[model samples]
Target: MDIYSKAIKVFGKETQLIKAVEELSELQKEICKFLISRTGNVEEEIADVKIMIRQLEKVFDKEIIQKWEEEKIKRLSKVCEVVECAKKN
Candidate 1:
């Protein structure tokens, strides 16, 4: 009855994966447009990407994905600190 269930019924794993990629691409495009023209539906594109990501969670292991995401964030945070330090120097 939920959106994910409906989406799964209509579009299977492979189709959903493709749609996810498309949605992410759209989000990226919107972000790039914002950087240049400073006019684009960035929020709407982000929402679409989030919806597609949740739809993806139905097929992928959410816990594992989240765990890896946290690890990546921690690693990126360290990299950000290094970059900041270099900038200050």
Candidate 2:
């Protein structure tokens, strides 16, 4: 098992879930600071959130998450196509 899997196993799902929420909140805060002041550890917070997301993928059904991601990407592609068409017209 990987380090994330090991950490999840040792820490329990509830604890990891809470940690994920905390990491996401920190990332949000960093993004807000960067938007307002043009300065914040946004990259570091993003890395932390990505690490927590990886742990979450291990804890949950990764396949289901992947399916959702694919669907969202497809939807986004459609939106991009519409925006591009508008730009041309």
Candidate 3:
């Protein structure tokens, strides 16, 4: 099945999860296409691809994004690399 079908299977209704899952699904399709087309699949290599797919599934989680940004700021602050955060207005 293609990305759209897989997305609908995963998220049946038109909700935020549907939107997020569709985007992730499309990304997975692209990655899978590239890897399969370019390198050809190796067994362990395919396992790594599956791990990346799992990560993609969680990409839309707000808590994950928040923690990533928090860690980024902390690291940059220590390195004196802090600039200004993007302004909303």
User: In order, what is each prediction's RMSD in angstroms?
Assistant: 1.6, 0.7, 12.5
Q: Give residue 6's error in model 2 in angstroms.
A: 0.8
| Candidate 1 collision pairs | none
Which digits, one per residue and each the tens of the lDDT, describe model 2 over residues 34-73?
A: 9999999999999999999999999899999999999999
TM value for model 3? 0.32
**Where does candidate 3 stray beyond 4 Å?**
1-14, 39-64, 72-89
Q: How do all models score by TM-score?
A: 0.84, 0.96, 0.32
Per-residue CA lDDT of candidate 3, range 1-89, in tens?
76644554576535535455555566566668777786433554556555444444554565787799799999988666434433322
Specify the highest-lDDT model's number: 2
* Per-residue lDDT over 1-89 for candidate 1, one digit per residue giving the tens place of the 0 to 100 score: 89896898787888999999999999999999999999999999999999998888888999999999999999999999999999999
Sliding window of 10 residues with minimal summed lDDT for model 3: 80-89
Q: Give the TM-score of candidate 2.
A: 0.96
Top candidate when judged by TM-score against the true structure: 2
Report, for every candidate in turn, its global Cα lDDT versus the true structure: 0.92, 0.96, 0.57
Candidate 1 ranges beyond 4 A from true positions: none
